[model samples]
Target: MTPGMQIRLWLRQASKTQVGVTAVALAGVVVLLVASLTTGGHHRASTSVAAGAGAATNTGQGALAPATPEGGTGTAPVAGGTSGAAAVVSAPTTGGAAAVPGAGGTTAATAAGGTTGATGQTAGPLTASDRGVTPTTVKIGFLIANVGGLDQGGFALGLRTDIGQAIDAFVDDANKHGGMAGRKVVAVKRTEDPTNQGDLKAACDYMLRDQQVFGVVDSASNIYAATQRCYTIDNKTPLAHVYALSADFMTAGGGYDMTTTPNLDRIAKFVGAAAKQMGFVKGGEHVGIFTDACEPSNTVIRKVMAPAFKADGAATVDIAQTDCDPQAQTSQVPNAVLQMKTKNVDRMFMATSFVGVQNFLTNADAQQFHPKYFASDYDGMAADLFTKNFPPTQWDRTQGISSGYSGWLRAGHGLTPAQKRCSDILVAHGLPAMKDDAANGEVISQCDAFLNIMVPAAKAAGANLTRAGWAQASQRLGHVDVAGFQSCTYAPGKYSCGDSYASVEWRKEFQGYIQISGYRPANA
Candidate 1:
């Protein structure tokens, strides 16, 4: 019998007492794991280091109120003023514009072309003069993963912190460079649990309703769509870099995704292209698809990628669904591997997390089975376990489809100007610099959204900025160029910035991945 069969027989022959004890232990472990995953880990609220003269005030409940609006500096208060009272002057009801009370009870009017504030300055409809904007500051909130109760053990610990730091660093740099349109952007940080939908909603409520930020940005989490219900559906808050979740979040009236991480359908196309490149398009190749049912996006991967591969000439396409939780993946991966072995699959596509990928690779190695592996960006092909734990021989046969450029990969080829800018900002803020795939990817993705997308949208919005104005500005964007990466575009109806991808190959020597193909249209 094969090694896999031998292990299976041994597991079957185990005594009832031993099996019962092991099952009990696993149940207890899962309980502890679930408790940790569901609870909010750590909570912190602070003003961005770059707040400078217009530093934010920490309100109760981890909310940070915008800095005081300065007069004559062209800064205007919100319609209700700082006290949140009713406006002294009402907005225009007729064709002839009526003046409304602005910051500090200043009169402002919305005109045909733009908005005119108390200072008689006619700026674009979306400018620093709008809500959360002062001549010297613009307030934004960040709901990111950080500080779990356990000692750096939660999903949001290291990776989320790195992303937050990158955002802070970029804001600081922008402040030093005269800020966005002369308004220093202050980032109010709030910790969140990615696995807890309730926590995610609470974070959104605190940021949008309580804090009253001008706009929200960098809410990176696994269950990010849950937060969208609070911001997009309920509150209509303008969010930036909202591209990390499935396409279900991008309903007509739900929320807008401003970054170019392809939706499920686009990702399926990417996978299909990679499969063809890996010689899996031949009629005789048998393919196995592994998905984590716990992840909403995985449903699309299983349903969409399978058919795409089959149509590309995969003789037989078998799919396996598994739990994504790390502990559950431990047992699920082994059984899935056994099934794959039974079918003698020549290629395997993974729609799961790094943990599931690692476990399957371990079992495959033990069984002496080597198959061409395909995975989406969800696997995070960084220098983590795939480099330190998994054998290099296995990596050599692996291929990844990335929706965005990997900073670690770019750094290996020597930091581009954009990469250098990110590093410089991190160093300037006295934060730990990006060194690994997780850190680099987090920093790069956040910075790309902030600098390339958010900044430009704000600039286009002009000085009369409102949340609605910002959303309109983002929709008008087209062919936006990202430094050290591909260009993106945005339009009405379609919120995805760039529908392109880069085919990457695993390089054990670098302990990361390298792009074998430059950015191209996803369908191409």
Candidate 2:
């Protein structure tokens, strides 16, 4: 599809609300998963979407990688099967800018390798508490996609009522609760065209340079690597972003940028470990790995995948790389299917986007070869579209690891205490309670951007209140908790929030994904 078409398709439909339409959905790309949390690790990154119900799950801004991976900044990679400029991840995908967490492994020149002190402590210009801190309040900026022009298909994105009010609701509640370290939390929000460089640059300038907020909460904006660098690296600011992250991106962030969920680079490890524990990959099972041939993805084969499964007594493993070209990425699926059938492969690791996974499954079925499919839900695997649209023949009885988004979430079940508070907070703020709304994930994610990560970290920063202090203090959260999520673990070097993921399988009769297992360490 043309990039514009891809963007439009990514915009899923949602019911409108009075405040505005809180909608976002990728009703098309059905990456079979448990919510792979590429929603980045599910790969949709759970990117931010302004379409449909405001999906908060995969805005597909993880789609925000540059034309090519460069410098220190890493691609966002939203939902697994999500498509668009924001969530491309070097592979072809469908749907519009669903914040399908863009994929593509970029090398990081920053701190994953070398020990770093704190985020935003990199070499850069200095400002007072990263330029937006004050004694009485810490100014934080937020970047969200400007869906104004993208209001097609009758989905009127409620910029103010939904997005603005939702944010205000969170901010107001935080302040009422002693705020961040007893200081009122001030948030400045800016919207920019994710696909436009000028717009992105201007937005960054306004937030990073003009507003000089202490940090930024990035929802879904597949901005340039340089633009990202401007906010976190060069500008010495910090960001809590919702994108599928990688070690390289963490390095690019100078250890400053943090993904809301598990990172893409760790998907291999998470899936492998989760599979082994779930008995999906065990001794005597012939496993097949179908993945994109990219930097970190390629490395995942030997460095992460092999060891994870092999040590579990997997008899033999076959690896295949999907074509990386957006147009031809899945060209090899047929051959890969043939190989699976010929080799008697019984288990398959869908490391590529839902596009590639669906093709492989279709080709496999054509050959009457059905191997149990499992994945980490990246590249769109765990997206709502994946569960609803995926073929039951291919998706039924499959399971994987995910930190967030799944058939359960899509089914509008499983409300956590924290999620309940989100509703209450909204209602208290005089907004509609988004119970099963399409933008439910987006709104909740926005709340977590502060409630879960930024505010808590800022609180931990205490009076120091510098960007560096925020990064260092984040570890103070220790066993971080966020309802409806399996893991929100934090550590000094761990910039991503997801650590443990739950195992889930698809239920019959189109019930979508159901969790079969609880939290397990991704590194295990």
Candidate 3:
């Protein structure tokens, strides 16, 4: 079907099925659990999702890498299918992107030997199979969520399209500078119904089974899970997730490794910290926690808000859950606004979607049930939504909203060498304005991390990086520094990053995000 037609059909189908809608609503969450998994790992993550719903548990191998084979080798072969060989490493070669340094192997320019680090890790040693051979080109796939209504008024669409467009720019830029290593980076775009896990499974299965993509990069939460399940379990394909928020997707233990921040926890801390700050000044002692009484977000709300409320010094923290139906935004807003009037709530923290937040705020303004508004980053989308529905000035009452991420490449961070090169390529490819999204940049980070660790380990062991080679490489996927935004840990599989805690208050004067000061860890 045409992409347009597919999205409309998907949205209609989603409106009929409860699971489908939930997947779309909490697209950010489901992606976290299923982005990567061996068959066993898929089962484990699926079990986690079911457990969150208080359902019976089913077992799967939680994201464990396959085990090594019998002894006899220092390095594995790079061939396909259970050979335990090191995958031939190739660099993007169009421009000067430069190939990865050969592990303990002599290239025409560099020596083959180097000293081992104190960590007892030496450069990877190449096997006879890698001798005098050029590395094969690696294929990466991009599954974008650009379907229209399927995402409930383009929520997923804006995310995937905007991000995908940006990433495409990034890839073009990278290709101009030379692709990764010596191989040109190619992106294959596919769109699917993220809300339907079955559909996601089918789409991803085709990518891995037929298309033979080495890895995947995507922007939807629901699709993340389905793809991870397909790649890890069905075909042993690895992935690089762009905007998934569930901590599970980005961590090694869950069998999925995403490149974006696990937002709920970060947002919870931001709201809680902001609440405490407002309380000190406004004498606000109670915290009202509001969230969508939907599927995946409900679980995220519970995980992120419960702890945040506890930390806010709230004498009592009351929670309000809104309707799961997307259309209920109209009704849920008024209900929440009315309920807030009866309760002696000192402060309010909302965990919801852009439209829902806009409805709640618009209604609250009309009803004059204004309390301190502290919400997650998704609330930013509300501003645009409000502008489209109401006048720009109507948002005056809802000002002083603050949220932060590792950093915004579009906003400019003096561009890393890699980013600069990537940006240049995009501009050269007639996408000068498109480089602002940096969608693919995030994916590149994930893939870079995967390669940075895996390539070295594969060469060191001289094992071909089949599932076993990747499994061996999985041992060190923990505790990586992704430039400057945040630090990811596969060991604990938790996300700790920018604006760990931040708050924005609607001062009668100024309106905008205000970063919080005095940083401290959440557990601390």
User: All models: lDDT?
Assistant: 0.49, 0.53, 0.39
Q: Write the per-residue lDDT of candidate 3 for residues 1-524, one digit (tens) a residue.
A: 00111121123223335434544553321111112222111111011111112221222212322212100011111111111112222321112121333332233211333222214343343222221122323345666553444345334423323445555565554444334333334555565554444455555655565555555655343333333445544455545443433333233223334343334445444555555555532433665665554422344445555555665555655666554434454455676666666676656665555445556566767777766555444323212211233222333434222323212332234554434544454455565432322234333443333333323333333322243333334444555443312334433223223323233323223332223332334331
Of candidate 2, the 10-residue stretch with the lowest lDDT total is 1-10
Query: What lDDT tens digits, residue by residue, belong to model 1 across residues 58-161?
Result: 11111111211100011111111011111222211111111212443211222233443323346554344566676545777655543232222222213434
Clashes of 2: 85
Between 1 and 3, whose TM-score is larger? Answer: 1
Relative to the true structure, candidate 1 reaches a TM of: 0.68
Model 1 misplaced regions, further than 4 Å: 1-137, 147-166, 176-182, 252-255, 324-327, 381-388, 407-412, 427-438, 483-485
Provide the RMSD of all predictions against the true structure, rounded to 1 decimal.
15.8, 12.6, 10.9
TM-score of each: 0.68, 0.69, 0.60
lDDT of 2 by residue, 49-91 (tens): 1111111133212223321221212445322222322221221
Please tell me which model should have the higher TM-score, number 2 or number 3. Answer: 2
lDDT of 3: 0.39
